[model samples]
Target: MENVEQEFLSVIREYERVIYKVCYLYTTPNATLNDLYQEVVLNIWKAFPKFRRECKISTWIYRIALNTCISFIRKEKNIPEIVTLTQEADRSEEDDETQAMLQQLYRMINRLGQLEKSIILLYLEEKSYEDISEITGLTVTNVATKLNRIKDKLKKMNKED
Candidate 1:
């Protein structure tokens, strides 16, 4: 039991950033982000024992985190919280431009439907089509189709802005 607990802690420590990134992208409010992060952690711990070595640990983490975020968002639909893109206060000038672009991108992402948001998030994270497909339960061809359509949607949205 102690060994399992320790292993869980180690896994959480290694993948904390990835989990946090998923939570951040899904949620805007700091409080909600924290809540979602905790939920993801709890789910990870609960599911750890059943984690077969079939997929990479990171892939498993992504699947769990994304599912938690999506479910939470669905449940919180009535709350109507204000969503923001960036949370950081202090930033270097160089970072400002990149941050601004990211903020704009996230703004667009926020408008996307839940499934599209997941696909784009995976793509932004540099996941390969196969990895995204596995994580999302979409076929590789479906993932490719969705990504292409999402790109076109973003392009149109940007042009309209």
Candidate 2:
């Protein structure tokens, strides 16, 4: 394989979980997971050659993944308003109660708007506010404010559930 191809593959392998999680969270009934995943990889590959060492690779990849999914949804007129994420990534070994709780959480998350969902996902990934801001192109203060609002929204959702 060419050096660039090899490097791209390496980066994708290293960040596959991030890519998959983003795709998984954005999948809708019309936009299947595999379809979204393939489109994201394709986008990353197309832009790999032009990617300079300006920002963190993870941030770039996250941007591409999110943009790809969001654009695909927009093209398909799908905003991913449904929550059908499977127990395929992790926590498959959790007890039934834990799994149920997780499903409920996913359902609530799926109800959020695209930006809100993205912020919450990054927060759950343990990304710092700075990192989230970098990936999301939001100011640190905006990320913090939105995060607090998202948390309150989630809490309200849980209470109403």
Candidate 3:
């Protein structure tokens, strides 16, 4: 039990940034990212004993974090007007152009329904189709199909912009 606690602590410390980033990406205006982060941490603590080290620590953490975030997003009933990143924080001249692109991309992602947004966020995080499948409990082919459709939709949105 002590070992598992230590392992979970180490894993959380190592992957805290990934967790925060995922929360920032998937949560909406009405969603409290901090609240979601706490939920994910509590979940990890609760599930830590079940950890068998069946995969890389990173992959395991990703699975837990993604599942927690997805489940929270799905259950939260009140959807608020989508908040743009610029509205959350001001851009600086020192900010990388890459960030600006991601801000625009997130705006489009916010337009997607809950499940699609989760899929797209995982895809953009450079998760493999197989990894996404495992985390999402969808087949690889389904992940691919959804990703292709999402790409098409984003492309169309870009064309309209």
**The candidate that achieves the highest TM-score relative to the unseen native structure:** 2
* All candidates in order of lDDT, best leading: 2, 1, 3
Ranking by TM-score: 2, 1, 3
lDDT of 2 by residue, 14-129 (tens): 99989999998888877888899999999999999899969889989988998898888888763445756586646757877888888888899988888998899989989889
Per residue, candidate 1 scores C-alpha lDDT tens digits across 1-161 of: 99999999999999887888788777845347789999999999999999997999989999999999988888777654535765532345548788887778877887888899899988988999999999999999999999999999999988887
- Candidate 1 Cα lDDT to native: 0.86
Q: After best superposition, candidate 3 residue 25: deviation in angstroms?
A: 2.3
TM-score of predicted structure 3:
0.83
Clashes per candidate, residues 3 or more apart or on different chains: 0, 0, 0
Per-model C-alpha lDDT, please? 0.86, 0.88, 0.77
Deviation from native of the Cα of residue 136 in model 2, angstroms: 1.2
Comparing 1 with 2 on TM-score, the higher-scoring candidate is 2
The segments of candidate 3 whose C-alpha lies over 4 angstroms from its true place after superposition are 86-97
Angstrom error of the Cα, residue 103, model 3: value is 1.2
Q: What is the Cα-based lDDT of residue 56 in candidate 3? A: 66
Shift in Å, residue 125, candidate 1: 0.9
Off by over 4 Å in 2: 78-81
